[model samples]
Target chain A: MTFTLFDNEERMAGRAEAALRDLDFGSDEARAAYSELLDAYRKSLREQRRMMRLGDRLQEQLSTVNQELVRRRAEAERALQQLRDAQDSLIQAEKLASLGGLVAGIAHEINTPIGITVTAASILADQVAGLRRQFQAGTLARSDFEEFMTTADEASRLVLSNANRAVMLIQSFKQVAVDQTTADRRVFELKPYLSEVLTSLSPRLRRAGHRVVVECDEGLEVDGYPGALFQVLTNLVMNALQHAFEAGKTGTIRIRARLFDADTVELRFTDDGNGIAAADQGRIFDPFFTTKRGAGGSGLGLHIVFNLIVGTLNGSIAVQSQPGEGTTFIIGFPRVAPARPVAV
Target chain B: MNIHDISRAPTDRSPEIQFDPDACSLSISGASFPEDGAAFYGPVLSTLDEILKALDQRCVTVRIALNYFNSSSAKALMNLFLMLDDAAQAGNQVIVNWFHAADDDTMKEFGEEFAEDVRFVRFNVIPTAVTS
Candidate 1:
């Protein structure tokens, strides 16, 4: 409002002197008021400059902080991606390890029959050698020959039957093992596939004195990955065997399957054994949270089951259990599972 | 009498186990995933036992280089390391060298775990470049 007061100090002082010489102020009081106005205007200008400097400093600090935050966010994202990759690889490794255990089980099963065959074959070989020596010496008797023939026949039968059994076991195992290792989607009948998985698990079941009674409707076909289904079923059955029952405790597992609707199917797995505690039921699906630590429990079985059902199959599962009572798992999945599985 | 050297070829399911008493060294390499883990590692364990018994405080090095192994094989490895630890405690210099791929964090972590379990044995975990 007063341009003279805003001029440089030398110019303002000259203007004040000129005004006084020209008698511009009407009285002494008026001159004093003009001087005071100049002082206030100079003070206000100083304060404005100081505020501008402060604003610049604050802006610089904010920019530095923003840059640091962006860098940290990028680093955190990289770390998170690395963690995801590690988790994926570990899950796959666990699956391979489970398959390795299955292979070991089948091998042990086959070894038994092979051992019997080896013993029987050796006995037959010895009897034939004796017969050859007796015939060569021209001292072979009819009773001796008859006895040797009987022994050979019995040994042959034993060898053949046991060898045949081993072959059958291998064949059945081959199908289940192949299905387990591969994840290619294919249409398959539900009931028979369930039976195959159960049969493959027979050795574990028998060892634990557990009986599985499957009640599936006939001709219930599903369009999905049998391999995934096999893994899901295997995990459920093994979980029950490991966690549900106590040592030397005979338990019965009932598996029932039916069509939930046109596009979905429902499967119920129940066991009459020790149930999970209420506190632990929620965290049961968490990876590596096992109550049986140091007792040969990997604690990944149920986690893997959960991943397969929800992540791979695009399905849902629920568990209902109470302490001292039986535990039941209900799973619902689309008849035709998703074409591509969701990566973890 | 000294323990004889053992040389086993690698199979699809098991690793190659080579133990040379003359060299005072044993090396197991490749994927150690056997159908019958106990049966597969049984002879190796027994041979090591015999060598340790006859070692007479001689320094022995164990080289374990596995790309993959199952849980059961992990148990077997634990037992093997324990045996070596015992031998070391008995005044035998036992050195265990665990080799893992540079990018294999899980195997490296496993090596670290095994190292924690053995006190007397000189545990060395070395990361090497991954071969094609």
Candidate 2:
């Protein structure tokens, strides 16, 4: 079609139709057709510009609103997180204070058995020296030598028992401290660790007359902080001893270390004392929660134990305790080269 | 609104951040160490993986401005940088702009730690006004 639409002096092109699309106008016209079109078109453009201005203002307001919401939410979240952190820190601090209070008691409890063990060993050494001198004399007989050997064995037995007793006492405290304090890590042998820990706890065991059986893992290798694990074992063993054995009675504490996984070792400390109460089981890991609260007990023992195993050791601890039966603490830790170097 | 990126500030003790897929730029600013940093940042990196595919332009610049991250988060950030390196090496122009304040030595060291791992991409430690 050869239609020259732009030839006319109409500055507004197809103006009537444009307004209709913008706001739904009707066919009814009030003024001259061209004037109607122009006025409507201009008015529509003016309205659109006004609406755009309003929309922009609304968008700006919305942005400010959104930013305000975000800022408030962030502040609220930060405050909440800080609240949680403060609570956790307070718990840790409380645990530390209590541990400090009990440390002396633990040390004292451990020293007695150890001192006796040393004294017994010293006496035994003297007796062995006397027997040696007697044997050197020409009049000394084979029967006498045999009797001396037997007596020496008895003294050795006494020394060994006392030594172990002293060791257990120290170990309990060590375990409690190790769990509470974070330290550097290193590679260590398992058998020695088990013995050392048991030695430290021996005094407490003796006081309670709890016999501890050790089934050490042969050639076991560990690649984390030893002190932390030491603390964990100490707490578990002593916990078994003091709670498992009735006052004025005796009990048995069994410590078994074995390979749990390709790169993990599990230590199981079990005792035949009456098991953890069903009520106390759930609250055991919660800091400062303890049934033996009045007995100079720093209720942070298990909580510290759990933290050591899970936090410092990067492992797990499980307790299987039953009322009137016994309690067992099973801990598993990586036994090979750690993925990262531990701060030792 | 679609700013889908988060990072640990060089000196701040905060959490790690994730990038929004819809934004042209992603930023991570804060201290990171929420207990198990590996567990937290693991999924966030995975989330950024899907969003990176939707970008049509051949070039993507990801800025990492972290103040301080724990060892665990440090490992996670390494993994993340490696991921970006992979994407950048595979015909997608990826640029990693690591921003650090001039005074924060720790953040600078951390940024260099990742830069050491990256093979194909260019990593720049932009020293700006970083308040500790």
Query: Best DockQ goes to which candidate?
Result: 2
lDDT of 2 by residue, B1-132 (tens): 132433333423345454544444556766664444435665566656565655555676777766655555555566567767777767677788988889988788777877888997788888889555
CA lDDT of every candidate? 0.83, 0.68
Q: Please provide, for model 1 over A21-82, each residue's C-alpha lDDT reduced to its tens digit, 9 standing for 90 to 100.
A: 67768778998888777667567656644564455455446657988999999999999999
Model 2 chain A poorest ten-residue lDDT run = A1-10
Across A123-173, the per-residue lDDT of candidate 2 in tens digits comes to 878877877787677667778778877877887898888887666655655
Cα-based lDDT at residue A158, candidate 1: 94
lDDT of 1 by residue, B1-132 (tens): 334535679986588888777778899999865655556766667667667876676899999999987655776788788888889999999999999999999999999999999999999999999888
Give the Å shift of residue B69 in candidate 2.
Answer: 46
RMSD of 1: 33.6
Cα lDDT for residue A99, candidate 1: 87
lDDT (C-alpha) at residue A46 in model 2: 61
- Model 1 spans with C-alpha error above 4 angstroms: A1-39, A127-154, A241-252, A272-300, A311-314, A323-326, A336-344, B1-132
Question: Which candidate tops TM-score?
Answer: 1
Q: Comparing chain B with the reference, what is the TM-score for each candidate?
A: 0.93, 0.77
Considering summed lDDT, which 10 consecutive residues are worst modelled in model 1 chain A? A1-10
